[model samples]
Target: MGQGPSVIDQATFKEMGLLSWAIIDLAINWGGWAVSAALQTDKFYDMLGTGSFLTLALGSMAAAKVSHARKYLVSAMVALWAVRLGAFLVARVWKVGHDSRFDEAKKQPFKFWIFWTMQAAWVFITLSPLLLLNTASAGGPARIVWSDGVGVALYAIGLIIEATADAQKFAFKMDPANKGRFIDTGLWSYSRFPNYFGEMTLWWGIFITCTSGLSGAQFVSVASPLFVMALLFFVSGIPLQDAQAKRRWGDIPEYQEYRKRTNLLVPVPKSLFCGASCGPKSQ
Candidate 1:
């Protein structure tokens, strides 16, 4: 019903995001430690904090060698990406003050507990790769490999693309004229969620780099990418955004038309037809 700059300020958005993360972290960190201690071992290593553990794990496996540089590189790159995404989300949450989804659920005690607790679980599980890499590993070759070069290059490209896409979206939203409109410009034009695509690719590159040095358990670390994809697609990324879009533009004939033509997650060419399969028809 409204089309204008959000009344919500940036500071409030940041606070909401940070508070959500903080609440989730509190539940995971303390709950995880308690559970692990009771179990007498870190049985649920996957449930530890974010992928900071992956950093430590990779470092341990690499040991003190030339290849150790590769682990450090991977760790540094991932840390940067995580911090950047976290900060961005925090800013967005602050801008919105409180997420409507959270607010709605807050009225129901069971739903509130479950939602926040599950988010904490998701955060921990999703961050396994980084956490493992951060933990003390045996260390690796004291020289970098050709694989490291490729990994670094891929990661750099992914980060650049993701960062650019995010910036473009932010700038588009900041422009008052574009209020309540979808962004289909720059990298966004190429892919509906270029940022997410890049982020998913970045983790794969990191995983490849981390696994390049080893044989057994290292290969199993594919879980990191898998977890990220699941969370992004099903939990944090598209579904939530889509729901918001539907709420905002459900009554707009133009938006309904756009939704039919534009790709939901992956970027694709606009369709010429406006059939049921294409999506809800424009009024």
Candidate 2:
């Protein structure tokens, strides 16, 4: 298949306050990385996702002469999730180069600038919860308790499912024999977008961890996971991919049959009667 053509171009970054705020936030996040690396907390860093958490920890450690427990936990989770997502996107961008969808949106000069600026703003907005949550944790001593255990379990499960789903899709697409073929095996068979399901659930797990204290700052953390889930399921993730799928397979009877038998986001065991029973022509 031809690489999708760019529909937008000539976009430049705008000097907006929102953009400035986002940059400042990201810079603070970098500081977190510096201290985290120095402290040899690579595993913790990986789990937290963003440098922001580390930054929060560093700042907290400085003021209090000891780490605030809540800050440590929330920052760690935020950093882990952000890093995982950022790495995944970076890899994807490397493989495909500049995202065509983004390129297309940048075609009009004024619109291009706006789009680029919004991209920056979005980064800050989406991550604001983590940043806020981290600061909130710095206030006083907090205890890690049973809720923490539950949250950790949920996070672990979510990560496993999401990672497995992504791996399955990647492997399926890599095989030359599978070219132009729909995947209906492994995790793919379980849910149309198992990765997305896992993604939403993962954030909720993080949210659970952040909210264990039931503080006002913890309330702010709620937005991070909820916003991400909405963005993934509705605004950016599923809608875009589903549009492509419809474009590719809308007219195919086999796709229609598969659609009938499978859930969109939840995994269901493939029925023996449903699979072999579909005639060869449909396959």
Best by TM-score: 2
- Model 1 regions lying over 4 Å from their true place: 1-67, 107-110, 134-137, 250-253, 256-261, 264-283
- Ten contiguous residues minimizing lDDT sum, candidate 1: 10-19
- Tally clashes: model 2: 16
Question: How many clashes in each candidate?
Answer: 49, 16
What is the alpha-carbon lDDT of model 1 when measured against the actual structure?
Answer: 0.60
**lDDT per residue as tens, model 2, 1-283:** 2433332211111112233345555554444344544542322222223444334433433333234566566556655666666566556555544555544433444444443344444446555544444434243336677767787778777777887887787678778999988887877776688888877777677667656545653475577677877787887688998888889887999887777666677665545446775435553
Q: What TM-score, over all chains together, does every model reach?
A: 0.65, 0.67
User: What is the lDDT, from 0 to 100, of the residue 52 in candidate 2?
Assistant: 42
- lDDT for model 2 comes to 0.58
Model 1 agreement with the true structure over 120-196: per-residue lDDT tens digits: 65554554444444332433455777766777777787788788888899889879999878886887664667788
- Candidate 2 scores a C-alpha RMSD against the true structure in Å of 13.5
TM-score, cand. 2: 0.67
